[model samples]
Target: MELITNPQPLQWPTLLKRPIFDNAEIQQRVMPILQEVAKRGDEAIRHYTQLFDKVTLNAFQVSEEEMAEAQRLVPETLQQAIAQAKRNIELFHTAQYDAEKQIETMPDVICWRKSVGIEKVGLYIPGGTAPLFSTVLMLGVPAQIAGCQEIILCTPADQYGKVNPAILFTAHLVGIQKIYKIGGAQAIAAMAYGTATIPKVHKIFGPGNQYVTAAKQLVSQTGTAIDMPAGPSEVLIIADHTANAKFVAADLLSQAEHGTDSQVILLTTHAPLANAVNAEIARQLETLPRKSIAEKALENSKIIVLPDTETAMAMSNVYAPEHLILAVEDPDALGEKVINAGSVFLGHYTPESAGDYASGTNHTLPTNGYAKAYSGVSLDSFVRKITFQHISKQGLKNIGLTISTMAEAEQLRAHAAAVYVRLEE
Candidate 1:
């Protein structure tokens, strides 16, 4: 990791930029896959599955038999672990479920907003070097809690024409039956545009590589709702003299191993702490199984030495990392200063992995500086709040003139006329 001593605020933008493909090139690559799936349906999906995943599949949908086999293949201990994670996820998300309450904004206007689940939603789980079974829990548990009618999942099949047993087992545990062995931009296309077998969904959720992120953005432009412009995983740590170098190094490497493009940044008040953490990272990386990938990511990562805690917090806000860890003595005090971040991990013991897995917070988060405007996926992401209002005669009489006057000022005659008619009646 590169260590910089007090970079100016203006230089931070260039330093904080995520490693990504050129916008034109990413669009160019993803558009054809989306168009082909929209045109040829399941045939296009199968073709890409073979081309990208190197696996031939007669059917894209995982059958009952495959699900049963996956259950048998998954170890009992893992199943129990998944179940425990499910309960925690369920508890956290279910609390977000709210009861509807009608309120009177005006004298006789009764208005209430009710959250209705997105009827058909699709979840894309990346199936590559590591099959993210945890993601199924993160996305699926909330979809179920939100009462989505159809929850379709798309994951790539391995070389042997098999989806990971853990993935299959998690989906089953969450009651997601419509599993499709599709991957990459093609999987996004299959969900966005209804194919022969893969049904079109109202919104798409989950994190993926650049291709998947680009596909989601492209499809969203055409009217399909997406969770967020979430892509590669990332994390930023604000550590002080009290912070543990070993823990900080482990935290940074955890996200670095996610992908070569993944970026990890460290902001510290103590100058020597940067060197200590780097030494620990070097020591830890030698033993990590994904050392090659982590090493590649570290090439883009940085350890920035700031003057103090205030500057560190300010820099963190500008960077807007997907995950922010406050490994400081007064984490709560520092966390209060956080204006932008997808998820936050407080203290040395609270690693970002806690939120990613068993801690119940959704791991499907915005990346590449999107945390400034977007939030990580939650129960609310699965549902739309539809508002209903009933106006009495007195209510119309009270507000009708105001509405008519405003409409007349805007020169919208029809809008004014509608209110006038209601008042007259």
Candidate 2:
């Protein structure tokens, strides 16, 4: 990692910029796939599956027999682990459920908001370099908690034309039965515009490669809702002398291993700790299976030596990382100043991996500086909050004049007359 010492605030933006890409080119490539899916439906899906995934499939949906075989294929220990993670996820997301409470904004006027789940939703699981079975729990638990009427899953099949066993097991665990053997931009298109076998969804959720991301963006333009704009995974760690160098190195490498485009940053008050962490990263990198991927990601990453914690934090807020780790002496105190970040890991013991896997928080988060505006997926992501209001005769009389007067001032005669008619009734 490159080491820079106390750079000027003006230079922070250049130093912190994420690796750039030609999104227009990716969208240009993805558009034809979407158009084909819309025009030809299942035939388009089959053609793309053969072209991209290199598999010819007779059927797209996973049958009961395939689900049973997948269950048996997953190790018993993994099943237990998945179950434990599911419970924790359920516990955290279930607590987010809000009971409807009516409020009297004025006398005899009652108003309240209720959460209604999107009737149909689709989840895409990437099965290229990594299977990301943990994501199944992240998305499925919340969708179930939100009471979505119909839930379907799409994952790319391997060269041998089989979905990941762990993915299927986890989906079955969450009560999702509609599993499809589809992948990439074609999967997004199938969900966005219904094929003969794959039903269209109200919203599409999950992270994928550049093509998949582009496909989601294209579909969203045509009226399908997507979770958020996402990119390569990233993490930022703010550490000082108090942080363990080995642990910090491991955390940084964890995200770095995600992909070549992934970036990790370190902001520190102590220069010695920065060196120590780099040394630890080099040592740990040798043992990792994805060391090549991590090494490439580290090329895009760096360690910055700041004058103090305040300056480090200010830089972090500007970067607005998808994952932020406060590895300082007083994490809680520093946490109060955090205005931007998709998810935060506080103190020495807490690691970003915990949230990615078993810990209750959803791992599907906003990336590429989007944390400034977007939030990580939660129960609310799966449900829409619909607000309702009721007004009695006396309540209309109390508020009618204010409404009519505002309408009249705006030259909206019909709006004023609607209030006047209610008043007369």
Candidate 3:
């Protein structure tokens, strides 16, 4: 990793000059697929599935037999782990269940708010170099907890036109029945526009590569609500001399292995520690099977040796990393200073993998600086809170004059008359 020392004051815009993709180019690439799916439905979906996935599947949706076979194919130990993770995820999401609250604003004016799950939702699970079985838990559990009526699951299939066994197993474990053998931007298009097999969803959720992210933006712009701008995975670690070099190196590599576009940065107080981490990363990179991918990602990453924790934390906020790790002397103090981060790992013991899997936190998070504004997926992702209001005659009478005067000043005669009519009636 490239190392920088004595970096000047942290200026948000000057911290890191992030590269921006060509939005026009992305839209041009995604528009036709979206239009085709919107027009031809299943026919467009199947063609793209064949062209992109290199498999001739019978149809998009996975059958009961296919799911059963996938379950049988997975190892028992993996199944047990998935089950345990499912419980943790379910417990966390179920606790997020919100109840309706009624309140009186004025004499007879009663107001209330209630949350209702979206009628339909689409989950896009990426089956790339790594099959994201955990994503099924991350997305599927919240969808189930929110009580979405129709849940559609889509994933890119392997060369043999089948999803990862673990993907199928997790889907079933979370109560999602409809699974599709599709992948990439086309699958996103299929779900957004609704093919014969894939249902049109009120909202779409999950993270993916740049292509998939572009497609999500395309569809959402036209009207569909997306969870957030989720792009490639990235991590920022703030470590000091006391931090275990091995642990810091391992955390950086964990995110690096995610994809070629994924970026990982290490910010430290001591210069020697940065060197130690780089050496440790080189050593650890040798045995990993995904070394090629991780190595490519490291090309875009950097290790900055700052002067102090305050400088490191200030720079970290500028990065707005999808995942932030504090491997400092007092990690709790570091956590308190964090203002921009999608998720956090404190101390040497809290590995990113723990939260990615069994740690009871959602793994699908905002990336590419979106951590500045977006939050990781939670129960709120699957449901929408619709505000409700009721006005008793006495209440309207109390508040109507104010409304009438305001509406009259705004020159909205109809609005003023509506209040007057109500008051008179």
The residue ranges of model 1 lying beyond 4 angstroms of the native Cα positions read 408-425
lDDT string, candidate 1, 76-97, tens digits: 9998988988999999999999
Query: What tens-digit string does per-residue lDDT give for candidate 3 at 381-413?
Result: 998898989888888889999998999999998
lDDT of 2: 0.93
Judge candidate 1 against the unseen true structure and give its global Cα lDDT, from 0 to 1: 0.93
TM-score per model over all chains: 0.96, 0.97, 0.96
Question: Each candidate: what lDDT?
Answer: 0.93, 0.93, 0.87
Q: Candidate 1 — which pairs collide?
A: none
Compared with the true structure, what per-residue lDDT tens digits does model 2 show for residues 24-116? 998999999999999999999999999998999999998899999999999999999999999999999999999999999999889999999
State which candidate, 1 or 3, has the greater lDDT.
1
Q: For each of the candidates, give the backbone clash count.
A: 0, 0, 1
TM-score of 2: 0.97
| Cα RMSDs, all models | 1.5, 1.4, 1.7
Higher-TM-score candidate among 2 and 3?
2
Query: In candidate 3, which residue pairs get closer than 3 Å at backbone N, Cα or C atoms, i.e. clash?
Result: 108-395
